[model samples]
Target: MSNSEITTHDPTSISRKSKKKKWSKPKKIWVSVLVVFLLFLGGAGTYAGFLYSKFDQTLNKISGSNGKTANAAFIPVATEPITILLMGIDARGDGETLNSDVIMPFTLNPITKSATLVSVPRDMEITFDGHSRKSNYVFPHYYIVDKEHAFPKTKEFWSNKLGIPIDYMVTVDFQGFREAIDVLGGIDVNVKMDMCYQDSTDGTNINLKAGQQHLDGAATLDYVRYRKSNCGTKESTDYDRNLRQQEVLDQLFSKLKSFDMVTKVTDILNVVGDNLETDISPDNLKQLILSYMNIDRGKINFIGLNGEWVSPFMVIPDEEWENAKRALKIERMRTAANPNPTIDPKTRLGTDMKSNYRSSGNNASSDSNSSKSQSSNKNTDASSKSKEKSSTGSGSKATPTPRSTNNLKSNSKSNSNQGSSGVEADDRVPKVD
Candidate 1:
């Protein structure tokens, strides 16, 4: 058989293709302790850094069976890799551009590292034109300054303000957030108390038991946002709720790892994709999968912004936020210190792909190299041909393209930012859940 014919022979190829097209298929697997997402104060300390490392490894193992391809892996065909900037907006009643509660930019370096999640506090006070305003309110200046390009505009403003880069954006409204969690059969969270609180803007009356329980949309809303009221009864502060949100994310991630979770993810994505806007395309996702396939779960990293809030300028104040801006810019770009000292890159899969890419690209085009390439091609062709023959005799499709190594990222967006605003030092929730 000719090289092309021989390469078409493997049944493994068909199986692989089937698997790829059905990448989102539901599985029977169930992993409950998803750790990456933790409430900023509670769960964040434990999961953020380590969980991402493990998740990367998991992806690598999954992609190993599919042999790596050189040209088609992750390098975008038409453009540079995309960086998705996701925001969780908290818009209250009758609010428009001025109300973005949660502002975090998730940067995916489509080449080697997995997606980077960077969280910015809503209370950050920024100086736009001449007046000062909450960081959440800075979206208006971003939108106004560059009306034609939402993602770039928002990213540029935040990146410049925070001294980082904001590439693409995906902003979700409140309704989308609620629906996503609910569709995932209500995430499992560990609440510390039978909390009760009322929010006048969203008209939320939240009450839940303290302990490990499954939380529906409504309960999660209350659990995540519940801060003690001013009378010193309820905990209130972005610091307090950060970890809670992370916990919800951890649970959701764990759930997404399951086969049933696959169905839910598809459902959620379909339901809210339009609500979520982003510069990352399906191609970007494919590349991420390729790189993520090699990262070891233990090598993933996370960095926390360590700063106190200070009052100086506006509704929120600029001093504390200014300090935070200075402290957090590097961490936002995933250049933060590797919290786990023992985390090794060689052990992870994503890092391997990056290393491989470097090594492969460094080669010269020579006669010896050409011969070796031919030999490798021959072996691959033989394997594929064998599979193809089996499949055809058994009444099946042709050989399939293997699933390449790629990183994975699960995202959600908030609608608006309207609730309380102010700054205080050590604002992070003090305990881990």
Candidate 2:
């Protein structure tokens, strides 16, 4: 054979060429896959880092510029009990005085994974700064007087009233509340009654039918804030408002614990950063989330302190006040002893509101007697009305005594005309008359 033909038919060279071709194709494929995978990993890492940075920044903003790392009197530790005061500020109007109409003292026991929420009435009379005014006005009064020490003053006021350390304070404006709910795609609320109210001042027009329905931000606000209805519906008392607030909050908590919230964290953080203010440190806040993210909703007790409507003030009866204190104390003791404790729901300390405010109209009927007892109590002196004995007692069943005829007559007239203006008057500002 000729040399060229021999070279072409060489078995060794042919085998080598075939081997090279076979290896090169597979190698290119694997290299391409590896390059793509590395790019993906790098991109993921960058996104994660970005989220982390955003989270940190948002937390810092929520914590405010108080230069406080943790509570001065109480530091949140793992598996311990902590109390936080949540204040919902009513900032419906621009440059309007801020009033914390919704005041709830929340206690969380990490050991037992139980929580206690106590709602304070907005119109509850309290003495602060050498004057007697509604509790809701305290924050706004301080905010206008001493802007720098507003929160601190407010926290001190509530801590003394609740007789708890109150480790942290979280204040969220109405705008923030609305935005957060909207970001969560609204919430599910059982509307208790047909609500219809309108206000041209704040652009508020609330019309909601009673039913198991889905409420958006505006509707939810209207639901919680339906004090006086212009459409002949029954006016809502502070107690009713408190119950609605608790209901909305319970639903909100459930949504927060959902898997869907993971994707919406950034949006929530953005809203919170803009409108929410808290003294909780970023680290402890993160720790709280990690610890109680899966807390049982059934273990949470919602306690609303109801009392007789004495004009602008809702004077809590001695028995109801003491029962609330006992319930809160017992919750702390039970959780400290055991993670899960069997407690009766009728004791006012339980998760169910068997002894809720509305069902105990007898307590309201004895307003005169309760008021007398409250006035006589050494703790209820002019010097200090917030400090009372932490005594436990059964609800009072005293016979209904006649209230002041003049006061009742005047209050009745006021109630009938409360909705005439289409907006509830701010009690913080004194009338010019």
Candidate 3:
């Protein structure tokens, strides 16, 4: 055979060709995969940058500044205990006075990874400007009188009253609360009883049935705001509302920490930007989120202030006030000398008292009802003692004097024709039914 015509069956050349053919497709596939992964990383980085920018802007708006500068005094550092006043304002319409329907003092201790929340009753009587008025009225009065220094004045008032140093303040109106809840697709809550209330003036209509149910934003507000049932249904007191607020907050936080929240970040940020206002600096706020992101829900303790109903006012007992103060102080203290410390159960003062107002499991409503009955009995006994003491003129302790119904009626009639900020008398105050 001719050398040129004969097939040069070189084993080495065939092996090289076979090797090239085998690896080419796989190499191309691997290169394609690497390119796709790089693209993905770039896209993710761009998205994250966008989110960070958006968060910065939102935080700036919330902190009431156009720049990145924050108040130096309000900055929260690593593992430090700080108190924040959470005020839920109720502003029905434009140009109307703002009332803080919810007054909560939240204390966070990053060292122990524990937090304490105390809900002060809106109707609790507080002395402001040398006159006694409901606690909720204090903020509105300050806002109306001095818009510029209203927040600072409010912080001062609460700090003095509670005997705790408040480091920052966060205010969210009803509209904001509703929108935030809606953004999270609603929250699961177990309504204690059938709530039916209607008010034509503010356009509030609360109608919720008893049981575990998923509530939308408006419904959740109703669940928290239902004071009295005009339709002869069961009535809920301020304490009951406080318990509900705590329950709703817990559920909302759980949802916020879930994986589903990642997709809704922008929406949530928008809602917060529009409705929420906080004094915490953007940097400190970020630090706070990072520090306590994985805090156990069980470590958070909620304390409700219970008191006797005196007509339109809730007169909190002296002992209860002292207990709340002690709990807050203890929570602010460092639990251990180490970096990571476990919260001692014995040091949690007001946690056991929390069960007196709020209960869990199937018989929650029943337990609550029983607590209410006991409270009523105590009030009756108190009333009897007050009358007896007044008649005999021989008691060392002074009973709280109930505001006269006639005076309240006259004040309301007078203020009815006035503007939103023209709440001169106690009649304009929201009364508990």
Candidate 4:
């Protein structure tokens, strides 16, 4: 066998290949164009007639497996709800390592016809046993240790740390991300402020004008990758950059929903055939599209965990942690709870995307922060173990409120979008306007 074919499951193989192979500018362009085509598949499509045969044959070339070194189950269709970790990774200059540039969990709510993304910023500090780097590096570190098992381990780390159960993880690198956008003819979004920066070492040059504009693949990268800003009026931080990434992705999906995407289906398949990897198969992809295709963009919710800055790692407060568990539905043996739940031995803090907070004690509704106790973390007991080995808290009712980056105020619950009294949480998503 050739040297190239020797190690199928070694993480070092990526490095070896990187050193041995380098695609020319034209080849890179081709790869990008093909990948952009591949991205069109993420959106739903009806496969009847000759179209069905064509896509099926192309998808056959795209590989599927656990996308991890360890064996994991293929999550089946469920009525309760499902969570998919959409990870955007970028190759380090050396190509030996890849960092998760964007980490967002897109949860599909069948009942509400909505999807909520609880994005974890790459810089969110969490202890990874002995070492603690940005949350994003976890993927690369694990991948290097064991290529096949890396993904499962990465999933487990976040699951354990955040107290949220993740059903599946879909990883796409920066190259694929850029190409995908370019192929889709780019995306239009409203940039909150002017951004200007340059990093020759990494080949990142971000110079975007503030306000609404169109961004191609490279500019999309610039827009999202931009964490620092020259604009004095704007807040330049990891959190804001993450918000931009989510906004761009949301806009991208909105644009891709058109019939025009159908033309790019074949090219999309081949491009992503290599660039994208997930435990989910092509069939699973199709099932997802069919299942959550009607998601209301307006009801799409975003929640960010509020953390107390600890020297190196951002320590989660107890109240926030409980609220997070309640928001994500990991507290009970609910459909979305971890299959084998283990109480996190390490003590920490939490809250989530919609800024939803479910207290272990209260079910009362408060329209404003004034009605709520300002005593600061009333039932939030840092010493007490979570309700169970799991973080279930059914007593906490959902109340819709404005999202907060700081304390993550207001649990938004919608009567119109009734969720599983037992499985799903509040879905009274605020209008995006």
Best by lDDT: 3
lDDT of 4: 0.50
Off by over 4 Å in 3: 1-72, 338-433
lDDT score of residue 348 within candidate 1 = 22
Prediction 2 global C-alpha lDDT:
0.54
lDDT of 2 by residue, 322-417 (tens): 566555655555655465555353443211111111111112111112223233232323222222221113343322121233355565556555
User: Could you give the C-alpha RMSD of every candidate to the true structure, in order shown?
Assistant: 21.6, 21.1, 21.7, 14.5
lDDT of 4 by residue, 1-433 (tens): 2323322221212332222233322222223332332233334333222354444444443323211222334555435466667787676465554767678766665555556666676666443322224566667766655565665555554544444455667777677667767777898888777888776766767888878898898999888888654444353666667677768767776665666765665455444433555654345554554455544566566766556433222334555545554455432233333433344544332322222222211222211121122221223222122432233466644332222335422212332232232211211111111
Which is superior by lDDT, 1 or 2?
Answer: 2
User: Using TM-score as the measure, which candidate wins?
Assistant: 3
Evaluation by lDDT, superior candidate among 3 and 4: 3
How much lDDT does candidate 1 score? 0.41
Score each candidate by Cα lDDT. Answer: 0.41, 0.54, 0.57, 0.50
**Model 1 C-alpha lDDT per residue in residues 1-433, reported as the tens digit of each score:** 2223211111001111111121221110001111122111122323334444544454344334332222211335122323345676554444333345567655443233444454555654343332234456555444334334434445544543443444445565555567777887887767776677666765667767678898887687778767544333445456556667666665665565554544343365443432333343333333444444434323323323333333321122233334344333323334334421232222221111111111111132211122343343344346546766888899975432211212111100110111122222222221111
Instruction: Report the C-alpha displacement of residue 193, candidate 3, in angstroms.
Output: 1.5
Off by over 4 Å in 2: 1-74, 129-131, 335-426, 430-433
What is the clash count for each candidate, in the order shown?
75, 0, 0, 21
Q: Lowest summed lDDT over 10 consecutive residues: which window, candidate 2?
A: 7-16
Residue 163 local lDDT, model 2: 42
